[model samples]
Target chain A: MQMTDLPPAFVLFAAAALLAFVRGKARWVIALAAPVLTLADAWAIIDIGASTVVPFMGYQINPVHVHAATPVFATIFCIMLGGGMLFALNQKRQVELPAAFVYAGGALGVCFSGDLISMFIFWEIMTLGSTVVIFSGRQEGSERSGLRYFGLHAVGGVLLLIGIVIVINQRMYAGEVDPLAFRHFHEMVSGWTSLSWESLGMWLVLIGMLINAGAPPFSAWIGDSYPEGSESGSVFLSAFTTKTAIFTLMVGFAGTELLIYLGLWMALYGIVYAILENDMRRILAYSIVNQVGFMMVGIGIGTELAIDGASAHAFAHIIYKALLLMSAGSVLYATGKRKCTELGGLYRTMPVTMWCGIIGALAISSFPLTSGFTTKSMIVAAVSEQGAVMADLGQSHNHLIVAWFLLEAASAGVFLHAGIKFPWFVFFQKDSGLRPPEVPWNMRTAMIIFAAFCVLLGVFPGPLYEILPYKGVAAKFGATVYSFEHVMQMLGLLLFSGLSFFVLLPMLKRTETISLDFDWIWRKGVPRFWNEVAMPILQTLNRAQKAIFDFFPGAGSESRLPPELARRIGTNWAVSVPVLTITMMLLLYLVVYFVVPMLT
Target chain B: MSDPIRKYLNLNDPKLIKWYWIVGLIVLGIIMAVDLAVHHHAHFAKDGIDIDTTPEFYPLYGFAASFFLVIVAKTLSIALKRKDSYYADD
Candidate 1:
């Protein structure tokens, strides 16, 4: 069949969900096969130019305009889905394979969706799939985290739905019928001279995309719950949700100046928290926010070069980050340990896992000859260029420059904490005396493939660069003055930073504790303080009000009973009735006095 | 010995696993030097031409920096390695 004649990805999504409803190993096989087939279908139709607009069940489903940028994202999501399934195969009892498949398939649907309505449908499906994944953890805190994760994502989905409705309404009012086409959707929504429906529509879309990107204040849900997922489930949780938001941002809100600062804040926040964290998976989870922060900054810059950088970084990050999580998952699987203090000298037995983890760490740190170096530099370089050209932008440009530097510094810090610190403590430090066998070959192979890609992209970036959206606009993959300087600076920074780590080595050792972050507000402080202190105070005040009401007996002729009985019965009536009467009488008296004086 | 010198170069104690420190530093230093001399100038450009940073200086700087770092880390590790349960149980 021609590529244009292909079926919608959502059909495959439904198939996966149906397969998940089945029992046993057969379900697992179906779950695994679904993503592989979906990936193949995506790859085949990625270059198809024709728009296939099918109206199904009162909604328009259009597979149109498969661009270079979108496919890169879709391709990575496919790869992540497949790898995550393989990693979770042994742990499939925690969550049925079909659920994971459906969840991953929903992400794939988001990738191929060509218009706003289709995007919103797939967006909610992605949220539901992820919440289920979190729920499957069945841990002490998983339910609450899952609920918060659901609540925040639902808010994002509602805003996206509102934005889509406004856009559709405006198009209908203008007598435009084609559902597949939106020529400059942002411009269309923003072109209104007044703060009308269109402007509201634009802001709604922007806010929706921002929430998905895990922008601050709303960003706490991710760090709160993601690490609480079942070991392998967290692997699936890591790949899609925020990156899909980033993908949407790339589609809808690129070049919006506000995102640059928002992205910068996320980058720094992740670094600060990750540095203080002792939980292995939560550390990795924060690093996800940090990596996505780079992509956000790139999107905010909105140049062809910057967008390509964002796209490439997302692709690289998903693989390496998943590999990192899988490594942690394997350790968690073997030792029943997720905190760093409970883990050490694992490399003695789990050498393969440790080395794979190191590769992931190196990639995340943007070390030269890893995927991160090739992709992250594009965004940094774009910011530097912006700084040089737009001098009059003044504080904005300075802020961008500072953000870029903070991002770089955070990269070094990530290397210190997650990269070197993680593997060094978990795998190579003083022995924990637990000699768990190496992970299964399938898990190892999955990790090795991702690690190999991290190195491959680092060494030979040409293939990846050629497929980027801004392929023609950015510097080609060759020797340049900036590239040379970048290499020197990277090497120097790594060396100096490594030296500093050694110098500070005495203080860098693991501790038997968890560091506080945003989650602490909900996890320990507010709930405890409110339950122990605030609730009792309110209860006491309520009782005091009741006591006052019991003591008072007011004027109505129902004083026929004994005074004690009257006080007891009338207390209930007296408090509310007298208060209401006194309030009304005071109002009436004031009105009469003022009006009478004025009339005289 | 003075504390600063002892911290940087106390490779005398056999119980300290000082050999591990020495071997790690030597291997890292050699690798850094070789990488500097041979691959220092390798780079990529937009026109697809491979070029060196300055034909002479960048690699030397990289090698020296890398060597110094590896040695320092190795030395520090030797100084810092305590009983296996130093922080584990505490």
Candidate 2:
């Protein structure tokens, strides 16, 4: 490999290593300088369209290569790290920043990976780094939450690895020269709606990516684990993992029809859950899923402009989501509170934070002059544009029509749940009799900077548009992004949504409650089933064994059992017993699926 | 050190809140009214789904959609909602 072909991820990796040992002002220097340097290096690589291939186990793997979407995603990942570091500067937990760096480094690494093997490696690195970030939060239950988070992502990573292995093996058998090339799977795009053995690997890959993107069933992990993070640690956590998955999906599975359905579900799911959610951070976490759903729809549309829209939206989403989280983090920093029920009337003492939070809210709602308006509108326009194209082709596009309407409805829903619910409940609702000062200067500076990006990109989206995968398409769309009719429609939708929030205020009252999601299957349902049903059967079986043993001549003499033996057979194994039993069951399943089938 | 914007932004101030709501509602009304004059291009013209172009369609849809979402969420809460500490207490 050439010296100039170094991956920009090394910059953050070096900084993360240094951050582990550095102290005082030097830590700040490394933290601030790392993202800047990484951005420059990333751009240089992107500008050159560089690639460096290394031989790994008899296969050529490009660990450092720029793809079409690299500039936008890599640039935003670097910017997120910088802004997140700024927000986290005052965080006394020494481990968060370094862990955040490693996490972001993995995300950046994924952006430049030109092969599936490298992508999977970086993907797992992200899971590891982010799990550390959660653990470092030291919040109550953060340990268990982090473990749960890690366990889910580990399963996702395994799915992706198995899919990669199968796909590469299939490609090799087919005599393809480059078996591991990470590019759009055009064949699957055509026949994506139905299942076939040939497309099984791609299907596994898509499910794995969807899981990371916070799609259904797996969606609860975002809200479940993110709220357990420290104020700023959650800020860092909110940006990287899902967006990176979005980057991968845009590359590999663009134009797949199923993503549209999944996206629509995620969009509405985020809103409904956020509406019932009482925790302020969880509310924002759900919105992340909601916004990602918009991007997913655009990727599914799979036109040049649509892909551009998804890329641009992911870029803008990261900034504003991080901004929103930072605002919430600041509130938590000042008051040590995270629930909407416990906060209100903070505008009296925390004007900076309140305004920043409001700006983030407006931006997220795609108000007339914010980043969300400039970026997210592209996705909406793409849906209509694609519908028109299908009409010209004389093909029925009923799904596209439904998708357009649902996306529009989701746009309004975003305003209600996140834009109105977040700020109104946290800053302007009935006073909870708490007066907390503004956050420290570093946090305020971070919030202001991100909030400014929201408006700046909204007003003059030229720079952001230029970096999109389809710059010409984005720039052409940017021309009409602020047209009078478009602006008015968005305003009418969002304003009326705001009105709805007030109109339905009584029904939307905050409660100290959590809504059970699909995770309830594992978190509550599985444990309950084991304890109440499965354990009883196992106990009976054990008792039957003991009875049979007592029937033996010598066994009857020792029926009382030794203390060690009794403890081993005890009923109260807390978590380990169920965990072990489940593990063994999974092992049996593996045996039945692979070894037994092979023998047959 | 003083927060001057608090005087107007504070929700606790009755007069300010009353005027704010009046202005906000008027803005929504004006946007809806303007919908009568402007012709919204049909997004799915080939599919003949031009209902989106009707006057005040956006505002009406926005209100109804959010209302539906809130009601649906509340109904779901009846079955799925639990004390925030449900998991922790276990």
Candidate 3:
């Protein structure tokens, strides 16, 4: 069979299934090699033209379609999996490896998905895989956080599924030939002002993707759950979810105006919350939202150059973000501590981790020779480029103007909050007198590989630009990325931001406090409402019902029921009684369905 | 545990801390000067005032924005900040 016949995702999924039955070093071989095999298969199929579509369940589903953005995202995803698995080599959590495979598998599945139905399936699969990964943490309260994460994603998945169904049905009614095609929603977005079924469907689809992208109101999930994972698990957790959402957003909702506002909010929101955070992983998690904001802004611009900027940034982001998390994970793995308050003075002993961490930090900050400098510059340039074109056309593009200023401000904020904060506090701040040994060889190797990529990509971004959706646009932008004017501009902004950090050092002192977020409403507010208001009312109603029921069957007869039945009904009567009542109602419905309708 | 990296980067050493800031400030000054040598392009010139085209615009803006974000976060912590154990019972 042709390589196209076997979707690359299936390779990882099958490996995940196999990992469950394997033991010892054998499991490592399979887990580590799974990504390599899948990448090889992915490249083979991508090299062949177009998509290989097959009829599945009465509809055409091209499960192995490679879009322009697909190659870059898929490449990083495989690289991330390989690096993450390497970091995970020594962890004893047996279930984590398989779960990670499942998660990465689903992420890969979406990269090749050619239809809405297939995309939704892979989306849900990713949710399941990631939820299991969180649960695999098995630490205090991990179960609850995993459940909440799963519940929120399930809600998003339902919204997406409902949207897909609506769009499909509407398209069928309109006699559209390709009703279930998963393509850009430029048409639907342009007509959004006119209320119609298709527009509503598209809006639902956008919201669904945004939720996964860590947009506001639901942005708390990233910080809340990611830190809950085992050290390696968090590294694995960091890579796939939001980046996948970004891929879909770049694909489906590119150029949509609303994304610009939502993206800017996340950018500032991430910096603010990260500045206030104590947990190392949580800080990185918030910054993920912040960084994704850049990509979203690029996608919102929707020009060929802008989309390429977003795609190339996604590629760079995955590597450096993973590198950042890997180093953080190394610290967490070594000290068994994730709090910045407890972590310090590690530059001495863990030199490998320290330097790797520094490299990651600089890269993340878009330091001159780091991967972030080359890649993130493109997104900023795309904005300016788009702004220039819009001005030439003399269109009303005030939003573009505001977006550029805020994004620039936010870029400096990124360095201040994450770039400096992460490495300084973890490595050089006041000596906590905790000298944890360097991480294992495998983990160190993983960090170095990614660290090297960060600098290499920054120095020479041609390899990355060549794979962007618009090749010429990205290639041209890459040529100017390292120009003396641009590099000097970036350095001036970032270094001054660094100077501000030292200036505000006293004000930036770590406090062992969590900056409460929107999740507090659901995690605390909703539960408190249920306990204080809703539960009390229900309990009152229950007491009254019990008083009436106490008088039923003469009370004596109720007490004289069969011992087994009475025992079951007595202690748990509140729950069992409703269950029995519901069962009787179902029996009545069944009787009516068979007998009453026939008699009528 | 004769670790050499500690001796090299140890900020705890007052002398090193002194040199650290000195070098850091010098680099910042040099970069700010270099900004004058290069022509700054305005990203959104037509709609907005040309604040970006000025020499040292990036440096001043970066410092101001970074400082502002921290002050704002600290202010927000007054209301949103909770004890680390706030969610412990969860």
- Docking quality band of candidate 1, CAPRI definitions: incorrect
Clashes in model 3: which pairs?
A371-A454
What's the true lDDT of residue A54 in model 3?
83
User: What is the TM-score (0 to 1) of candidate 3?
Assistant: 0.93
Q: Tens digits of per-residue lDDT for model 3 on A138-193?
A: 76768988999999999999999888888888889999988888888877557656
Q: List-wise, what DockQ does each model earn? A: 0.06, 0.75, 0.74
True-vs-predicted CA distance for residue B41, candidate 3, Å: 1.8
Select the stronger candidate by lDDT from 1 and 2: 2
Worst 10 residues of 3 chain A by lDDT: A552-561
For each predicted model, how many residue pairs clash, with residues at least 3 apart or on different chains? 6, 0, 1
The top-ranked prediction according to lDDT is 2
The order by descending DockQ is: 2, 3, 1
As for lDDT, the candidate ahead, 1 or 3, is: 3
- The candidate, 2 or 3, that scores higher on DockQ is 2
Write candidate 1's Cα lDDT for A394-479 as tens digits.
Answer: 44365665665556565655566567767776776666788999888878888898899999988888777776887765446333
TM-score, chain B, each candidate? 0.34, 0.90, 0.88
Candidate 1 TM-score over all chains jointly: 0.76
Q: What is candidate 2's CA lDDT for residue A377? A: 95
Please tell me which predicted candidate would have the highest DockQ against the true structure: 2
